[model samples]
Target chain A: MGGGKRRRKLNAERSGRIAALPSAAPAEEPQAVTVADAAPDAPKPVPRSPYEGLPARAFWRSGVTEQHPLRVADLYRKKFALSPSHQIATAGSCFAQHIARRLKGAGYSIVDREPAPLGFDAADAQLYGYGLYSARYGNIYTARQLLQLAREAFREFEPAVPVWRKGERFFDALRPSVEPEGLASAEEVTAHRAAHLKHVRGMLKQADVIIFTFGLTETWEHRASGTVYPTAPGTIAGRYDPAVFAFRNLTHSEVLADFLAFRKRVREVNPTVKFLLTVSPVPLTATASGEHVLPATIYSKSVLRGVAGELYHRFDDVDYFPSYEMVAGHPSRGFFYEPNMRAVANAGVDVVMRAFFEAHGIEAAPRAAAEPRPKGDREGGGRRKGGGKRSKDDVVCEEMLLEAFAK
Target chain B: MRLCFIGNSHIVMVKSAWDEFAKSHADLEGEFFAASGSKMNGLELRGRSLVSDNPSVVDQLKATSGGRTSIDVDRYDGFVLVGLNLGLVNVLRVGQDHRTVATVGKAPFGHLCSDGAFDLAVKRQFDAASSRRIAEMIRSVDQKVPIAAVPTPHASRGITGRSNQFWADAELLSARAEQPWREQLEDFIRACGVAFVEQREETLDGRYFTERRFSVGSVRLRGMTERVEEEFRHMNADYGALVLQDVMPHFGSAA
Candidate 1:
């Protein structure tokens, strides 16, 4: 019985060897082809290892550190300096406002391209979800959607209003749910939208630098019109047509394509403008998609990151700033934001700004230690006034009064 | 004299006290830039503007002033900063779709400040080496005018058991638990060189009960008002009384 078993094992091993021989024979063909190709003019293929050996010199010592090298703040500062003379245009998620605020604070010119009226406060306009770049009234969920909005706005057939009229700031139709008593007419709204689109196009023409922040890859779109809305239409204010509304999760390829298209459109109008893109550090407030919250956040961020990488590689004039890295990178773990709504911490913003200044070789101002108050002047001794009770009308109109009267 | 209060709900109680005091005086001029859930960061009032994004109270002040040149600073005679414990603010939401859980911590959206991006950012703001930018703005408006920084109030007495577990859960955090929410409040008050009022100690001494306990006292059994009144008196003597004294000058002048 043992002899019979040994014979059977020998036979199985022989068959296995025969089976492997055919695979090896096929592999040899590539070797033979390489050897044949190596003759004379044909270059010899260099053998490479997956892990390359360390260079003879310490390449890192020259300037690179072991840590992740690029920082968002530094990039922003460098770009800010490089494009000092450029007219800036900003739009994207919440973080996009950061660029606008920074640029405005730094005294760089941001094109007055909002589709609102002159008297409309820019800050208030933003609260109503206007003034941000893109035509879907704020439907800028990703770089691609922003490009699509820009394209559609620029290509409107009837031209609801002239594309480039001066003194137009708000789109009356898209204004927030303020009291309807003083609202503009529908025609005025249409006209404002047209004028706003025109201003955006003109701004595109004038801008030497367009800073766009990539906020999220998830977006809700109108299926029929292919129009994207900022929040789910109902999330903010707008007509929601369930049949027309659809959720979309943008892929990296789609983002890259949209970015490239956006660049093309910008170049078509203002050939000399450069693009600087940054991923927003703000996290998702809530996810509508079915994935786990953490995973969803990761996926959304990863897609944006990939898009940023692809665009940076493809375009020499376009640069990517690692704002996402600065805030959410593994080392930092999201410390720059406050707890509740993930508002970026004041210190976090300062860190980003400081890096920006350092990278650009600009001097940073020093901060004085917060001074402690004298002990003799404690609270109870001080007299209090002006905290008075008011009528209901007074209470109701308080915000309005403050808005109108407060400096 | 115009006094401006920049703060959140902790100032609500102060506002209540001030309102009561004002009823008696009837002649003071003041304005409050206070909202129910606002921060020194100006997160609620500023929307997407720099005021909302700035981490430093000084930065928020600058942004609210609409740049350095626009801040008259002299318009107000006194500045009272209340409730600087940003850690207590609810800034981020966690969990899955439809079952999302909201928590307070640094870096509400992404992990920017949670990871340490804010430290670097703060360093950058301070590194500018010019205290005058912010200090001058404050002084220009009210030279010799006192600036008061009020510390954060303590948590109510009733947040216990599983409810309190949410405070330290990995998925979310309260701003109070993270930074010097309490300490920073004290620091802001101290730094401003005004009368400092520490309200947490009194509030923690069974004065402000949680919603659960407050409900129980109000509904369960009879004769609960005595206990409640006792707690209120304790808080008044410990916390409210101090606040009243701090702003006595303004009160007297108004009267």
Candidate 2:
């Protein structure tokens, strides 16, 4: 008999004797039987290793190489269930807009504390940073940026410089792109930021789930106050001075600590709120770090991924969604990127959302009706055209402006 | 001088007032085209004629214009588009819920909006108005034909405690919110290259409410012969006569 058959016979005999033991009895200690204990008729007992009964997922040959990428079953098991009633607030990098749109489209209750003004169409509304997130804080690229926003929202901290200027227009230093044209005066920027913070407070207080996508580890921050910005100062409006601004490539511990601090701050107002974390799969547009952009992106993403993993393991309420792996990982075979290999194709977003909805058992709702154009004007205005696919201009990313400076 | 008055339901008062004026003044001729609500949205410039395909609107146009199915642009010296969903009252309603840095502390309950954003929204509202579309259509047909656009008249008095509570909130707002928008409307109309006929100041209670005497027995646009007492939106012939007098001079006609 082969070793396999002999092992099957031994397994069956062992189970039969174990089942026959009394329910209250202690487990018997293994006796050191020599060759005398072996049955006379049985072939030498096969030596069975612990890996004998492991599932197919435990082995790379069966787990990955043999399975289709889309059919990678049990890839995600949701740590917590989300119902339609949950008031989900989403904010992160530009990629998180896809998650927000998908969730809102799925009939989940998305909190829009800073909703676009009534009668404003979708395109102009998005340009003004209204519908992109719950409170229009705009692309929060780093954990430190998020923590800073929360602190500012709660009035616990104030940045050294709250406003930045370009020509005659002034911008909020924290979320500079929110007002593309900028405000007329520094006072206007301050007032807008104040009002925005009030709504941010309301959003944090009301949300049951806060879905934040960890986008980058590299950031530009004020040297003195440690106030991190979503983009480098000069990328949008403010002047970039090396004396005042410093480039930071955040380490694993720093990113993890920033998130924990942010989590704690939010919990002060909302004790029971759950966190859903994701890492944006998009690579860096340009890296200020002397390292080549390729390795810089990998380092940034790896650090963010490591932090997510640590948080996922550390807390019961914190859940990590592998959107980064879904899009950037080799399983998709580079099929999910645009020709430039930077922007995520819509197909990739669809795949990630499909997996997300499947795991949560949420059926897709009918797609939203196309936005109506501004009355009497068939053209012009910031409205989207050409079917419903988001064009390249659909997402507003300040980081992409960094490439303009590259030689 | 020959002029054409075009608009939605609110044009009825202007037409009624013009008929009374034309009975005494023989030198001026006024042609009127009226469609109720958004029916006028279908009216477009096809070649040099302003026309529509909707049968009811066509019938109404024929009835109002002495059997003419469409207005020939070359025939009219000027055009006055009245009550085509353009108004400043909407600014007041929006202000009740949102305030700019200029008015933030004053309206404590309202959400704060940047002054620039609020200004853009106000401008966009005017840009999307149906009255602007009509002006554009007429301009495309005949750029030199002087075009004057009139906003919807203020809500009538005694609308305060009734079903029209929204007007009351607007009425309570001060001139701080009202003056800037009125200026914006003028600038917007001038930028469109159309003349703006300001609603008669004496006829208004504040900026948003017409005197009860002028609106007491306003007539419906469809059945122009009888007056409807419950109507607080349409003005009477007396109120219209005053506005028409202000509108005719823009056409270089004094009637």
Per-prediction TM-score, chain B alone: 0.46, 0.84
Q: Pick by lDDT: which candidate is best?
A: 2
Tell me the docking grade of candidate 2: acceptable
Give candidate 1 misplaced runs (Cα > 4 Å): A1-81, A114-139, A156-185, A363-407, B1-255
Model 1 docking grade: incorrect
Scanning candidate 2 chain B in windows of ten residues, the lowest lDDT window is B101-110
Computed on C-alphas against the true complex, the DockQ of each candidate is: 0.01, 0.40
Candidate 2 lDDT by residue in tens digits, B105-204: 4234446776656665666665666788888787776668888888788777676666534445555543444555666677766766888887888998
Cα lDDT of model 2 by residue, A1-407, tens digit: 99999899779868775554445333233223357758898786543434444566665556667777765665677999999999999888755677778888898999988877655667657667787788978778889989988898899999877899999999998888777778889988888888899999899999999999888888888999898887788867899999999999999999999999999999988999999999988888778899998999899989999999999999999998888888889977878877767677667777788878889998854434542211100001122322132333444356446654553
- Compared with the true structure, the alpha-carbon lDDT of candidate 1 equals 0.46
Question: What C-alpha lDDT do the candidate models reach, one value each?
Answer: 0.46, 0.76
Q: Write the per-residue lDDT of candidate 1 for residues A1-407, one digit (tens) a residue.
A: 69999899779868776445543322311222345556677675553421123331223332234333334321343333544566777766555555555555555576655433212233323322334443224424577557765685578423212111112221232222111121234444454355446656667777888878787877766676555544454322344557867888788888888888888887988887888788866666455578875787788888898888788777777877777777777556666766643455556655765565466454543321321111000000110123222221111111122122223
TM-scores across all candidates? 0.43, 0.76
